[model samples]
Target: MPAYGLRSHAWPVTHAVTELIAVNAALTPGRELYLSLRHRDSALRIVVWDQHPRHADPDTRALCEARRSTALWLLAAVVDDWGGEWGSGEARPPQQGVKSWVLLPQ
Candidate 1:
């Protein structure tokens, strides 16, 4: 992916996924895709924010998976159930959650 060439396929969201991609593409050296997202749960409300959208239409997500899995599952993964082997055991540390999951028939 070229730095100057990403403006065409770039998708702008609340936080700048495109800018991150551009910066990574320009500064980093590899053919990998980078994804960033945030999910927050407050006393009253829950918020989910993502950067790259599944479809270019930007209307609906084909799956309920979060942004990391969505990018992996849709763009870079060789297999359908990519990134599925990440351990979801109870051994997760204090700061990080063990794993994320989706429980629906897609």
Candidate 2:
């Protein structure tokens, strides 16, 4: 984040990634977790993918309202925007996974 002139966002970004990893690990023990960071002209994107094919999608309104995890709540508050989707087996040929991403404006 600092590399992209987003020094102020570094801590929040790190916390978001750590929280995502922890949540994935707790929910799907032993499953693989993947993290990706991308810098765009206007935003920085942080994504975490986990090998939990059948887990609930993070996009549902009900899940957002019912979420009891303080880490997730904090993550949502810190990031400018966030969302997730379940990767299709055909699209993610190597493994079916759930992808969660946070976007912070640059």
Candidate 3:
């Protein structure tokens, strides 16, 4: 396994690399961030979770929004060009955060 736990054969989208950069730019400083990259069903899955203030909380949603970087706009272009799907949602139970993910067909 590679340092990031991805298989040796796994590779990122050469032209859609902005996804990772945008996710990192949106993260909360000093907070925990988890990343997972894997190949499944002939596609590449990339997920990034951040321990930022949950968007479901109205008061903190603004805080989280304020932390978002304009760089995230690049994700749209990348996804469109690659025919990939990307979205974000609340983390699952036991995890209070957000997860942004993208799926790109191989």
Q: Number of the top candidate by lDDT?
A: 3
Alpha-carbon TM-score of each model against the true structure: 0.24, 0.68, 0.67
When summed lDDT is taken over every stretch of 10 residues in candidate 3, the lowest stretch is: 8-17
Write one digit per residue (lDDT tens) for candidate 3, span 1-106: 2454445324345434456545654576677777876777877787777776655678687656544534456765777667778777678978767777778776
lDDT of 2 at 99: 62
Q: How many residue pairs clash in model 2?
A: 0
User: In candidate 3, which residue ranges exceed 4 Å CA deviation?
Assistant: 1-18, 55-71
Runs off by more than 4 Å, candidate 2 = 55-71, 80-95
Q: What's the count of clashing pairs in each model shown?
A: 0, 0, 0
lDDT of predicted model 2: 0.61
| Ranking of all predicted structures according to TM-score, beginning with the best and ending with the worst | 2, 3, 1
Name the best candidate (by TM-score). Answer: 2
* Model 1 residue 68 lDDT score: 41
Which lDDT values do the candidates have, in the order given? 0.28, 0.61, 0.64
Q: Clashing residue pairs, candidate 3?
A: none
* Error at 82, model 1, angstroms: 34
Please provide, for model 1 over 16-35, each residue's C-alpha lDDT reduced to its tens digit, 9 standing for 90 to 100. 33433543343224544424
Ranking by lDDT: 3, 2, 1
